[model samples]
Target: MQRFTARAVVVGDRAGTVVPDAVLDVDDGEIRWVGPAADAAPAPDAETVDLPGVLLPGLVNTHSHAPMVLFRGQAEGLPLDRWLGEVIWPREARLTGDDVEVAMTAASAEMLRNGVTTSVEMYFSPERIAAAVTATGARAVIATPLIPLPGMPPLEEQLQHSVELAAGTPTGGTVEYGLGPHAAYTLPLSILTSAAAAAREHNLLLHLHVAETATEGDELLARHGLSVPTLLAAHDVLGGRVLAAHCVHMDDADLELWQEYDVAVAHCPASNAKLASGVMRLREMLDRGIRVGLGTDGPASNDGLDLLADARLAAQLARLREADPTALTAAEAFWLATGAAADAIGRPDLGRLTRGRQADLVHVDTRDLRFEPVGDKEDLLTHLVWSGITPLVRDTWVAGRQVVRDGVCTTVDAEALRADVAERAARLAHGG
Candidate 1:
């Protein structure tokens, strides 16, 4: 057992509760108790550690292709379609399992150092991705990629393999499995339904891209005369743990479909803006009770893996879209990266400082120059979302085990991983 007392503990609940002088107790990789120190029970047998800063639930990245870090800052000044069709796909075609493992190891270490403990990963090489996350002591939900590209197996074979992977993974563990159909435009309706059915059978998450750009679904719409969301509904693929990424071009009817089917959205503001994709109707979605979480997309697209930066960008874009500064408050923005994000991903065990939740915690050093004049609880939470505090993440813990300390990953060698990723990325860039 371990007891950690911090200057402030951000509960990360929907209400954005913050406790001053709080105590968080952990046992067997789960939170045993968390509340004000005055209301805690005595646990003399537990090792005690005092944190001289704010403690928050580790941020949840609802969508990511982390291994794409190998292509970060490449193919710049290109739109989404040209970017993928011209550069990304060709480079990805040459990816080996070892390349994926090494890249994911480095990416996992980068995210952990930035206080992202768990991420929803959709990339090739599921076993290698799992091995990388496990090696770094980080948590991940590996959504098996089911894209219909050249040199890849048929959709039926891919679906069967996804089912096998999900069936083999233990539920509610550090590593989970899901189904990631690349997108509606890239796949057929029959295959989409089949993938959703397989996900339902195994009780796994169904993640996919939907309506990212204005014309991504034009061909499908021309053929079926229905929007992507409605076509998905017609084929019975709307419900059952579906998580749609980049819902930047959705309309009222599409939003209605999401509400009706209880589908969640993974909003990637940074990537959307970078690719010239229009802003999502965040206020409208939230008003209609749609579960929305922030995502960094791929490291190559967003050019970084900082979920806090995405959270801040999400708030900024929402406010600009609504033409109201108060459209999304700082507290709400932070929640989108933490507790609400966990809910969007359907992981109730993460993203909270309550009893029975996984002890994935982040320590933000308040002594940093950026965090000044700690006025009140609201101010603290506001600073967390609004300020440039990514570099202030001093330590991080996943399931009660410290993985990052003093802004460094304790589980992985940062220097060696950087050198290895650079070499592999150079070879990949040259089409090898």
Candidate 2:
């Protein structure tokens, strides 16, 4: 049992601001109490940490490939398809379980240091990914990598392998499993049907890359005489349960389909912009009451898997698209990254600091010169959003355990991970 009292906290809300003299209490990894500091009833012998600056729920990266940090900035100037074929796919084929564990540990270490506690991971070797996340005590949704290319194993075999991998994982504390069916372009109709059936059988949410590029949408349209969303709907894949990443090229009909299916969107603005993928209709989606969360697609495309930077980019892109300053307010941007993201991953128990929720949080040291006065609600949020306080986060915690302390990771050695990353990345760069 422990109690933490902070001078102020940006409580997750639609109101879009902070609260002064906030107090938060945790027990067995869940928030037992929370309120104004003056009104807090804390135990005398309970361990307490005085966070005088600011405490907020840890940010969630709704989409990522954890071990792909080994490929960051490798194919710098290529588009999504060319980049994947020329550099990403070839390197991924060479990875072993040991390599995945090492690289994912490195990537997870980076996210912890950057105040991301819950991540949505889609990659190869999900067993290793789950192991690293469980050992580290962070939260994640590890989707089994589902490929539909030629010369591949049967769909049943793939599902069985995924079930086997999931069975070995005891991530019940903070990890969940989902189906990762690469995309509509790569997966055949039969394979997709099988994947959807597996997802329904397990009652798991489906995470997929959809309408990521113009070319992808075009190919699906020509082959099926319909959009990807239509195909998915026909196959019963898009329900209130799907987390669709990078829906950048959806038409109005597709948007209607998303609303009908109750699908959530993981908007990766930085990656979309960098890859020359068109900007998503986020404002329109939100207007239609579609759930949307923020994601830093991957380190290779975004060049940084940081959700604060992602939030900043989301707001900036909205403003750029609408040519209006009031496009996405700071509070809304924060929600998209944290609370909304948690909802997208089907973890409503997270994303807030209210009583009875998980104690996944980050403490930001606001005594720095950037935030002159942060006690008030709007000013604190303005400073946090507009003044660039994301880089000033000092610590992060997930499941009531400290993962990053004093801006450093407590689980993995950063220096060692960096050395391993450098060595592996060098080999890939030289095509050895």
Span of 10 residues, lowest total lDDT, candidate 2: 163-172
Top model number, lDDT: 1
User: Candidate 2, residues 317-395: lDDT per residue as tens digits?
Assistant: 9988888898898898888988888887888888877778889989988889888864556787777777777678888
lDDT of 1 by residue, 125-222 (tens): 99999999999999998899999888999989988988898898887678999999988899888999999988888788999999999999999989
The residue pairs found clashing in candidate 1 are none
Model 1 misses residue 185 by how many Å? 0.3
Question: What TM-score would each prediction reach against the true structure?
Answer: 0.99, 0.96
RMSD (CA, Å), each prediction: 0.8, 1.7
